[model samples]
Target: MGFDWSAAAGTLEVVPALERLELLAEPVASAILQLDDERIGVAEIDPELADTAAFCEQYGSPLELSANCVVVAGKRAGEVRYAACLVLATIRADVNGVVKRQLDVRKASFASMDDAVERTGMAYGGITPFGLPGDWPILVDAEVAAARAVVVGSGLRRGKLIVPGEVLAELANAEVIEGLGR
Candidate 1:
């Protein structure tokens, strides 16, 4: 059966993400239009509850159904590389291990909040993989890609996106990596 967004929505109302572009960051809205995927939906929420734990608690959503997209920065010699790691909120991304190796860098760490926000053109708590720079790789944990449906940031503090996991697997720059989250 398809995901029952209504049941999982708690007191929030969900509508087609494409139909509510005003609620998303510009890049995210454009990406959603380009993807033209109908299964994506958006729900408005209080900005104060944008963080994973608080959002899930306030919305009555399962923790397992939430995904976090973290921006990582790695430096090799004089060059810096960026990647987005998508993993289940219940676990942390293996930033210094698998991701570091994958990026082929000496050190890997989460980008500074200011840097991440500036680079992604999104709010501090709302950076999402959907609208990341085209040149940056997106590392999606296998478990997240296999989930039925997941709640992710909408590139805006006041909203969230509901999407089928397979859609993330199909993004052009996405790589499904096993054990990306640990």
Candidate 2:
């Protein structure tokens, strides 16, 4: 909480997340608050820089401290299932290897942008692990949950949320796994 934004490696300008990210979906905001609102911060950014690579490069967020929340959809016995996967920016989610087996589905793939955005009530490229459907599992890479802090979307392209990896580990139904990211 003593971060000197002015001296931040990337010139990060942090504000209390609850104040600047009012547009966050109900669930997303609640998740951050559940972690002790004061522990998280918000940084405004060009909507175009919301993606991990651009945001990290522009905001000075390190790839190792940035995480992506991806949605995977699959079917087993004509029953559809979806899960949210959290992986560090430095690696990709091992969808075919781990995700399929985890979901107990024969196949799995990234959900289409249209469906993900519509169902999550969050904009494309700004989906976070917060507020996901209750039945869906949130699979987090072990390394991601152990990070000091990580940057993730704020449910909108206009900003990002800074939270400690421990906050992620506490997420409802979060399953931390080894080799989840590769």
- Shift of residue 170 alpha carbon in model 2, Å: 0.7
RMSD of each: 1.7, 2.2
Candidate achieving the largest lDDT? 1
Candidate 2 achieves a global lDDT of 0.82
Off by over 4 Å in 1: 1-3, 6-10
TM-scores for candidates 1 onward, in order: 0.96, 0.91
The candidate 1 region of ten consecutive residues with least summed lDDT is 1-10
Point out where model 2 deviates above 4 Å: 1-9
What residue pairs are clashing in model 1?
none
Cα lDDT tens digits, model 1, 107-163, are 999999999999999998888888889999999999989987888899999999988
- Clashing residue pairs in candidate 2, if any? none
lDDT by residue (tens digit), candidate 2, 62-118 = 888888999999999999999999999999999998999999999999999999988
lDDT (C-alpha, whole model) for all candidates? 0.90, 0.82
